[model samples]
Target chain A: MWPGPADPVQDLIDNFADLDSLVRVYPLLLQGFGLTILLSIVTLPIATASGLAVAVAYSTAGTGVRRMLVVAIDILRAFPVLVLLVLIFYGLPFLGLRLNAFAAAVLAIALNNTGYFGEIFRAGIEAVPPGQGEAAAALGLHRMRVLIHVILPQAIRKVTAPLASNALELVKTTSIASLVSLPELLRSARVAQEQTYNPTPLVAASLLFFALLWPFARWVARLERRALATGH
Target chain B: MDRIAENYFNGAVIAAALPAVLRGFGITVLVSLSTIVVGISAGLGLALLRCAAIRPLDIAIAIYVDLFRTLPQLVILVFLYFGMPYLGVTLSPFVTVVLGLGAVLAAFSAEIIWSAILALPPGQWDAARALGLRPVPLLFLVVLPQAVRLATPLITNRAIAITKGTALGTAVSLPETLGSAQSAMAIMANPSPLTLAAALYLLFFIPLVALSRVLERRVARAG
Candidate 1:
């Protein structure tokens, strides 16, 4: 006998056979994916630049300032990015400064990421030999020039693996923007699933995410292995 | 200022929402602890399998870890919560979140433990083999103890990060800390509940962050 409607296998086939359903939702999901990519692209440079500034300040500051900066970074690291997003998106309006959902999400994610990137950059900077800076200075190079020519390039290379991994994380994290009603990939899939009463769109979205992120993940893993092998 | 305080920082609103948020926090703790247990055990099992170096299983696990590692936890949760019903495997929201997050934690922990195992000097393995110890006993007795020590700091840090992910349960309407606070905010039309939730999050996570630091320092000193 052919499988009937009550058969679980039949139901599963029916559930997944909704290719038309998936096709309908594809554009929405694509737009959402575009937004996710955009958010990540925008967030990375901002977070990294601010993080570099913080790391530099922390390294060069007086002991009192360094202590305070350390505390601030620790607090920011401890704070959940979701809570940060919520506080900024929902709570900041209380302070008479309202931001749209996109702006709020970007600000919160960037702030949280800056804390992580700052710590990473600081470690990278420390990994460079202090002698390099002194040697450059002794060569009659200005302090700023020494930092620019001798320190940052090495530090950036050292931190590339962590930074790339963080960037991938930020990409995945764009899903969280759905909570604030930003029409990112997850939100689009959810909307489609609700409208169609089928899970095919969600599956499509998962595949889309995997397709987008897998290569980058592999690249980061490769970089990390190389870095580790080089004793960096 | 008075109007601002009345609308956004109302003490009464926060007080009224405190119980709900605390209840949600209790759920968060429960979910995190339970997932930690599941994740670490699964991770240990996977690491042992990986140590055996069977080509097929290793490849399978590598794929599994890669999939979980790269995919967003939110997507996984959505799939399990919404997609599984088609397969005739419906789970409660709590189970869905736990399973989703636990899978991620397991992948990370497995990697940490496997690397720790690799970092063990080759002599240790050879010495155990010479002692006429079989693979199972040798692994259980010699390698794992040292690997566990090496893996502890990283495992703890990863565990805290994953536990913080319990907040994402809100996306699935799990009524965890963030979810409950969101509902309270909706009902009260004030952000006081969210503020309270933020304070609670800080209170909970700050200590864990501090502890992770201490552990990291100790590990560095030991090395």
Candidate 2:
């Protein structure tokens, strides 16, 4: 099914002969990978909070805020993350101050994630029993306090796997960091590809991505099974 | 940044890219539409396969769905772009993009449509069969309509996903909205209308998807 790359199997061996060069770029790649994790971690919290808030606003509030949030969420959800990334990353500098590549990437992703997270949180919170909210209200708890102490905890558990899955998507999406001259995994691979004149580095970097993502994918799978079994 | 603005919307370049981008958008629409067509049919077939009593077919669809679901869209795009060209097989950017989108969406779409199918209680299928509803009209007239109605909201989400995934066509230089903008910016050395280009993308997508959601809710409610 494939042609021999000289020396029979040795061509396969030789294709990746530049593996050692990755050692130098490894730290750089690790930094990029670290930044990806940082992006996801940073996004996970802020988006979760805001998404819950947005969801709450819509679920409870009048037509004005609900309609605004609906339109906002719809637009953000429909647009590709990269498109927004380009807009935010480049658009912000035009406004005066500028974030570095990593900050911009993180911010762009976080902004995109916030809409999604908001919907997820909204759904999770909505899944909570109405009686629970009523009880919390009956206890003289403020809406904010009730949300914080009563509703959010259970909703958080309901939405954990989804948020984690979104985190996994963030891992792959972070690969776009290469475009912005970020020293992420994909960018290092591109650099190594140029330096060694081989595709091995790119493949290695992809493998690195897969290695990073597989655990989360598996975890999500397990969580899905649990959710199913529990009849969530 | 200042110099980049000078060439932002060069009439000549935008004109050159316009035909190409329009053609690319056509291809995008074609791909998205075809993916919907093929993905829906194939997805439904797979869903039916899993629902069938035979373990072999059920197992086969399960693995097929799993394999396609687990693979990344980028990998599939790269493979179709780079891999098939070597085997005396060539495809236009249009076909490749459509096929790639179809391949990715089919797996998830199948499961989504299947869940919708499952939601109807097994009694529906039994009821159809008991009424002497054979496969064709039973599916075309009876089952799929209801399933489609049930799946409307989720399908809208898939529609948005498919549209976003089509942006990947820019990678192969198909001159879609993003590709034209990249070329425009690259030649002009200006990134201003990259803003405009981004705006145009949001312009194209935001309303289209919003309307689709409205349609989804309407269908969902009607169903």
Candidate 3:
């Protein structure tokens, strides 16, 4: 297809950057990309809210409740998110609770992130000085009001950096949804690569991820730097 | 409950799957250990080189670190294992998993150690220089130890996370823990092997998770 005999550079272009294959797979790639974004959007809030709930419970609960929370968090954290996803996607049906691929992926990821975000939120809550709550109570605020109106806002702000970092992690992790036949971006690229016998789609998908994620990564770094400079 | 036990926790299936799963776990250990060695050393090496701080080299290293940080390990593995054959550089599944994960871990380690070095008070360098220690002696004796201590907790957490990615090797058909259990499931037509695999992973990783907590506490206290 080249005007002259093929060279190494031409071979690489054909193999990894073949425009014809890229065009063919572009629609499938877009569909998968949309699902990836959808998964991330759906997961982030559920994980953050649920994790916040868990953290708040830990803070206010009795020792038994605290112990149970810790055990649950530790177990979830110990299992690699991939393994957790597999267990849920495959093992749930045996118990007669069948979840579709998207639901299964969301459940597994949300569960995993709940553990991580719980810890992050717990740390954020603890970082709020005790005086903040005392002063709120002194002002006649109810305990729940003190927690919601005073402490939580500051706690979430304090944890903004880790929150963003975890969010980035969640987006990247959506790739694993492909493993369960979810046809997310990575899976779509795999399908395209197989169908076209060219790997260009994989490269294109990677570049797409890098483009989507790099700015947020840089933002997280800046946040981290600000957090470090401000110091606790 | 009985049905759940029969499908997922059957004793006979567990016993039958145990041997293959154990063999796969052995491979997991091998791959993880070797990847750790390669990753940490290469990471430390890159961090050390970055300390020298030539502009072009620093930019190149930054790009490498950022690229790896952003790309998922699975994507990298897929590229290397499947795409690279087209470029005349096919890698075995074992090599691909090790190299792919090692590269990612190295990126993280480099960042952690670099930041740890940056976190060190400048006085240490000034004091070491005043003592007549050369750059090499100064870095090794004075700077690196403190930086490494600071970096250790973060690095340990990241290493555990990345090494757990050995299960990702199943994508390339590396017969690691997850892969073996999967095939065993196929042969036995039972999901019990997967249960065994999860148990095995929990057995290996839960302690490490607990240890990381301890390390985080110790480091915080020391600081």
Candidate 4:
């Protein structure tokens, strides 16, 4: 749901185009920026872990388990991250599960990422020639060992570029936590926007977002270049 | 007993959601259609410029691609949507999102199309020039057609990018499927409608994802 039209930041800017008011909100914006990064950092590992588990479950689950996992992942992928955050943060309390807005937003977004990333990892595993997997099995490698040794190294390499892009997506998504008043980057900017009536200050945070993502893209490109150079 | 009751509630919510959900579907379809159209045109223009023999122009377009492709769409939308209003440039949320997202899609598509263009046999361009097809017509008719053949799957992926990208709409409070669902759920006491909303989104996303995959295979076959 949209925020109420308090527009505190906008008001601040409207009342004074002075750099002073904008500067005053700098700390708030910084806090938001810090929180946004923290959320993404925390969410990434959780998402990757959950995603790995789900991928395993999808691969190893019996027909019934696989079907259930597929349906769950399908639903998760289809569900909007923002809407789910709202539901979990606001609606779940009535169901006796309670998380504050920050926790709820992170949980929801991380859960959403898990579905797609799980599928990505699953696809990565599937892309490994079955012969390799069979060879591992013949060597007496347990399924777990086979996966750890033969599949994951290659899969991690395969997914690195997409995972980098996914990280960019997750960074943008943490902004939605603002909707439930999580005091994130956008939330801080929204606050400043209402207070100052000037969104130019938000331009700073946007630049930071761009700054944070640009390196990841370059890193992915660098990885691709190295892979091509090595002909791997 | 609880299962029966829950199913009945779900049925009612589904019935209620049918019209609005269809409207949501309509919006997504339109967004997808317009995005592909506008996106491809911009993408083509960009790819042509970037892949042009002119070094300066190529560098400029490369920078554009890098800037937009690297950043997340929501952050850009926020800048366009909430940031522009203070400058006395007001756009409705829907327009803000569509254009903002269309720009990002164009940025990525340009790279995909440019690579596809580069992949074509240089002989094709040579033959076109020999036929006196001239620069513009040759690029449009001979060059782009082949580029489209190669770019089709990537373009479809761009389409999925835009489709999934609409989730960013919720960031700007656009009443798309997810937004409408959230507001509706807020008003309703039960989660049944949220459940329905999730189902409807799958009905949209799954097909798009699957179609892109199929299209990718087809393009590979054609290639």
Candidate 4 regions off by >4 Å? Answer: A1-21, A61-68, A221-232, B1-25, B119-138, B141-143, B171-173, B215-223
Can you write out model 4's per-residue Cα lDDT over A69-142, one digit (the tens) per residue?
Answer: 87677667766686578668765765667898878987998989898788667766665678888899999999
- What DockQ number belongs to candidate 3? 0.62
Best by DockQ: 3
Off by over 4 Å in 2: A1-35, A57-62, A94-97, A124-131, A154-165, A192-208, A218-232, B1-28, B51-61, B82-92, B118-120, B124-147, B211-223
TM-score of each: 0.93, 0.76, 0.95, 0.83
Task: Report the C-alpha lDDT of model 1 over B1-223, residue by residue, as the tens digit.
Answer: 7877786678999999999999999998899898899898999899999988999999999999889888998899989988998787998989999999999999878877887787788999999999999999999999999989988887898788888889999887898989899899989988889878888888888899889878856763564
The order of the candidates by DockQ, greatest first, is 3, 1, 4, 2
**Best candidate, TM-score-wise?**
3
Question: How many clashes does each candidate structure show, in the order listed?
Answer: 0, 2, 0, 20
Worst 10 residues of 3 chain A by lDDT: A223-232
Per-residue lDDT over B1-223 for candidate 3, one digit per residue giving the tens place of the 0 to 100 score: 7898899999999899999999999999899998899899989999999989899999999999899989988899888998889877879999999999999999989987887888788899999999999999998999999889878887998898788888889889899988898888888877899999998898998898889878866754564
User: lDDT score, residue A216, model 1?
Assistant: 95
lDDT of 3: 0.87
- Error (Å) of candidate 1 at residue A121 is 1.1
The 10 consecutive residues of candidate 2 chain A with the worst lDDT sum are A223-232
Q: Once superposed on the true structure, which residue ranges of model 1 sit more than 4 Å away at CA?
A: A1-10, A225-232, B1-8, B218-223
Docking class of 1: medium
> Which has the better lDDT: candidate 1, or candidate 2?
1
